[model samples]
Target chain A: MNDMVKLEKVVKVYGHGATEVQALRGVDLALEAGEFTVVMGPSGSGKTTLLNIIGSLDRPTRGRVLIDGEDTTRLSASSLSRLRLTRIGFVFQAYNLIPVLTAYENAEYVLMLQGRRPDERREKIMGLLRTVGLEGMENRFPRELSGGQQQRVAIARAIASEPELVLADEPTANLDSGTAASLLDLMAQLNEEKGATFLFSTHDPQVMRRARRTIVLHDGEIAADRHGPAGDE
Target chain B: MIVRLAWRSLWRYRRRTSITVSAIAVGTALAVFFVTMADGMYKKLIDEAVRMGAGYVTVEHPDYSRDLSIGLVVTGISSVIDEARRIPGVTGIKVLIQGQAVISTAGGSAGVGIFGIDPETERTVSPLADRIVDGRYLEGADERGVIVGASLAERLKLRPGKKLVLTTNDANGELVNEMLRVTGIFRMGMEEADGFLVQVPLDTARRIFGIGPDAATRVGLVLASPRDQSRVLEDLRRRLAGTEAAVLPWQAVMPDLAGFMAVDKGFNYVFQMIIMVIIGFTILNTILMSVLERTREFATLMAIGTSPLRLRLQVAVESLFLGATGTVLGLLLGGALSWYFQVHGIDFSGIYSDDTTIVGYAIDPLIKNHVTAGAFLLVGAFVLALTLVIGLYPSWRAARISLPDVLRSR
Candidate 1:
């Protein structure tokens, strides 16, 4: 059987012959179980594009992508969407919490999508709110909360379905440094204790410093791969 | 959860939702009012027609139906009457003879349609005997009196005590004239049926026309229920099939009346459709604006496991809820309007609606209103269906939202 995640010589290209932009060129990578990894790059470095392919929101152009030994490239779009719902989660830079929903409801939305019962949902949501240190603010809306609280709510929402993988695309880009640091610490704690594999994209050195491993992408290819507890490169 | 969210969402945008719901409600109320008004006017016309001696169904000789004359009486009249009475909804049966005759006055003379009826039997068939104004109706076997329309009396300059001569061809095709006294001045407001319309005793009419006592030009029937008129007509046909007589309803006997009523009904229907379309577009506008404002919210749900079909169903349910509420409120509003008109009447005496009776029916601007229950249900259903039809497209668009694009935008 294959490992937890595998990308063997994957390529993603845009445009035709003359105007081709190779977003990913012959990339090969593997993530073992319970890994906290960050893909870092400069502008136009294809980090977001790479994250999208692994998150099942986009397709690889010329190679196979697999998760837990199953080929993701062979799955239909609908099935891929189902896989994302059941086995993966996502957080975005804009704190993409639905503005219409309260924080408790926003967190419960994922559990409802997963078809969890009400009592089970109550326990999970309350536990998650306390875990993210936003216990009393569960009833607050996204607009009513501070930036750090909203990110915490987003984190609660991301892990609500208990997925095997979480792909966060520049999650702390809009937050202040203090809020961003706290958010990263919460995510790292979850990763270390719960064995949930996280793959995030960012260019921030603070985020990179906290990551267990950071893969740097330059011009659509891996420039430097670093692995340690904290900045052992 | 979806329903709760949808309902709560409406509350979040209170002004927008209220405006939308008010638009729907006003649309529904307007539709209900017009639909019931048309139906009430039509019912009044039919009720007056039935009350003024013409029953729901009329059986006549196939030959004289084209051009009626007392000289043309069908044989086997007794058997036809017996068979017609056996029909399930038949309340009463009456025989009548009609013909064009010249009534001579001291000054001049003019042609008029003379109606011959059996007075005793006619009392069971029509309530017109109760609406006598000036003098008594044709009462006894010795009575030779005839009732005349008020307009006809005015034109001829004749009074209840005046003497007039009515002349027509006999049933054997010979000319025979009768001298009679103007017994009563009966008035029904109908221009054609009453202005030049006259009614006489059947026995006197038969003797003058040289026709037999047992024959009649037509047999008018009253069905117990107006809605069961066709059923009674069918029964009359089956019973009279062996004889040479043709079974006829009022529609068959009076083609001109049927045609006029059909045109009026068509006009009413067109008006109804126009009103419904207006209501439909109002709902469409409101729902379209609602979906447009919630584009991002809808996209977030789609990004979760809520399928497009589920989202569409959610929208449809919301529409149904709104439509149902509107329909109920509208029905009540319409009922109130109909009742107001039914009691007080619409005073159109100001403009063109003043004193206008279309085609011998009393359709003055202040017409009597009579709303039936069938019309109430149909109008309610119409408004509800219109809301659904108009709401479908906008809801479908709401369901087709793409989350990736929505998330990518600023």
Candidate 2:
């Protein structure tokens, strides 16, 4: 499999001098294409920071980050933004959809950034919304939808542009067990059927059990990495 | 889509948007109203000044304005008056012989300006004939008869038919004294004119001043419309080019009033600038607060690959929506109010003890506002530009938001 993301000796420090806190300490990792992986860790264990560096949402303080074999750590901010726009998609813990836009518009936003033709964007967005089981609720805003529905719209948005990678930071943290299971099923179905790579961060045992590969982190370092048949997948 | 997003975002906080819009609307309306009212008042003042013997055009000896000497009288008064009458906009022309003199009675003595006018012709150029409050106006048959202002009459304790002595130098530098009977007492509602002016017949004045029968100090021309002052003056100047007389428009004769009008316009603009500054700050505060509240939302957009420039443009678009709505509403409201006041003037008589005059020009107590298309264009452009400038700060702040920090905070 082609490697999609590589982090080399990444280190992240917050604040300065004696008050500084080290969030990531010389972390090295890589994700292959079409992999359904979860980075598991307790609080303050650098799972979110590692995800941020991989997604190009941030730059590591003292290491190189590569996305699809391009060195993203040396790129300018604008170049990095373009890299994020064309190559990666993100889903936040809070299900960050633009409140003013409807679900359909929120899903179409990345395609709009890509300057896709209207008819093609419409076809792809409609298909994705249906794939995520949000076909009839396309016109509702985020506030009008439940947590599960909002996360589903966010997933549709993440895959609308057919990005190379999707980084979800605690995608199901706020949902009930039934909704979380359904969301995970949809994500796994997309990965198996379309070969879309997803790297998620979570501390939940149920979420870890649903991933095909699991990497455990403790005290800002990776403690274990393993791959197996995900339960019920 | 960006515009749609911005528009929807603005209405999300309905009460805050309404407050800002209302502030802009009220500020703009007041600016429009005050500017229109001031313009109308200035127009009225100019018209009144033209009617009070400073007719639209005046023909005088070249040196008479500076010296005021009886010896500097124009010799060919009849020809000058005839030429002035032929001008297209000229409605009337009158010969005037003005000199400084002293009037005395049993009660007191006071210095005054004596105006020699032809009663029949002067009636067409001045409202003095209509303002005779106590006695009959001067007629061609009444020789040695003078019209005094009510204030002057009161000071001299003289009534109609009472005689007073007028003393001034004739053409030969000798003091010439004449006995003049008061034929009328006029109250012009202007302290300068009422306190120190007395009028007599032209023939009587010429005889007392020892000049030729056709000689006069000045000739004043009235126009069919005050707006034609410059055109008529130009025509008169071309006609009287070779003579020793100089033609002057009323603005030249009343420089102080002209300068005062210019200063008044400056003050009006200062007032408008002050109002715009206050409204601009209000807009700035409102937009800044809105941007601050949406910090996390902005960070989300950035994370989702929205460029900082596009985010800033969205904020600017929101401000444009607010500004456009407020300005349009303000113009409509101000235009309607001005129209009502134009048709039915605002009466200020209750605010003053009596009719007030500014710089010897009497004005009616009722004032009207004139709403021109220019005023609407000016106020609209000003408000829109101000709102745009005020939008810049908030937009820049939005563009500079630290995405990671904001997302982490949320």
Which candidate number maximizes TM-score?
Answer: 1
Instruction: Give Cα distance to truth, residue A133, candidate 2, Å.
Output: 2.4
Instruction: Kindly report the fnat of each predicted structure, to 2 decimals.
Output: 0.20, 0.47
- lDDT computed for candidate 2: 0.85
lDDT score of residue B264 within candidate 2: 83
Clashing pairs in 2: none
For candidate 2, lDDT tens digit of each residue in A1-233? Answer: 87888889999887899999888898888889999899887888988888888877777889988888999999876677788888888988778889999999999998998899999999999988887778899999999999888988887888788777889989887777876787788778778887888998986566778788988888888888789523433
- Estimate, for each residue in B1-410, the C-alpha lDDT of model 2 and write its tens digit: 78988899899999999999998998888888888788778866776676556477888888877887889988888898888878888887878888889988987989998888889877766788889998889998788899999899998998899999988998898998899888889988887888898889988888888878777887878788767888888888898899888899877777778888888899999999999999999899989999999988888887878888888999999999989988888888888888888889888899854548766667777888877888899999999999998999999998777666677674
